[model samples]
Target: MAQPQPIPGTTIFDGIQAAKGYALNKMCFSFNDAGNRAAFKADEEGYMARFQLTAPQAEAIRKRDVLGLLAAGGNVYYLAKFAGILGLDVQDLGAAQTGMSKQDFKAMLVRANEQVIH
Candidate 1:
């Protein structure tokens, strides 16, 4: 797949602007805050449980491997949601957007969901 170039003037802030109605900033803030991180870590299993992911799916998330997460059936939207939660920058999002074909992206989402059921 041809890699996607960054959209000029685009930044994580742009993503935040695009996500105004989605509470993306709130999620990002929660994920970026040290206090929240500590709180999340305190009950990691429970938090992971909310995603209803299998062990390997959860493991993949812990590893922060985008391809692996995608291969395991995670939707890009949701993955993007998680990425936002992780404070992933727009550059990372652009890289992911550039990395695969549309069909491949759909397949990755299916695979990610399938893995979560295992």
Candidate 2:
């Protein structure tokens, strides 16, 4: 089956993207192990090299760019592990996505939930 046309401004986490992201995602997955997370923190470049990330993926990691990582074929759930290493939670990623401050994005989330309840 033909994969759908790429979405404008979005990198779909389809088979192709998954293939492209294998090394990157593998690296992120390692974060599940505390020792691996410490290794990453201890030597980021070395860690990325160990995973054999591509130039773009490694660049995204070096820049601490969530969006760039997504564009480089990172899956959000896996990327959260990477984010944790930087002391950023999923909410921080949400704020980045919405171009809002963390506080503002959190407020938006609360407001939206309240609307759904009332």
TM-score of each: 0.43, 0.86
Which number leads on TM-score?
2
All models: lDDT? 0.55, 0.89
lDDT of 1 by residue, 1-118 (tens): 6645766543232333344313322332355566656665677666666545666566766887665554455545555656765677444654665576556666777887999999
Instruction: List residue ranges in candidate 1 displaced over 4 A.
Output: 1-42, 94-118
For model 2, what is the alpha-carbon lDDT of residue 84?
Answer: 93
**Candidate 2 vs. truth: CA RMSD?**
2.4
Best by lDDT: 2
Candidate 2 regions exceeding 4 Å error are 1-10
Q: Residue by residue across 33-72, what tens digits does model 2's lDDT show? A: 9999999989999999999999999999999988889888
Check candidate 2 and list the clashing pairs: none
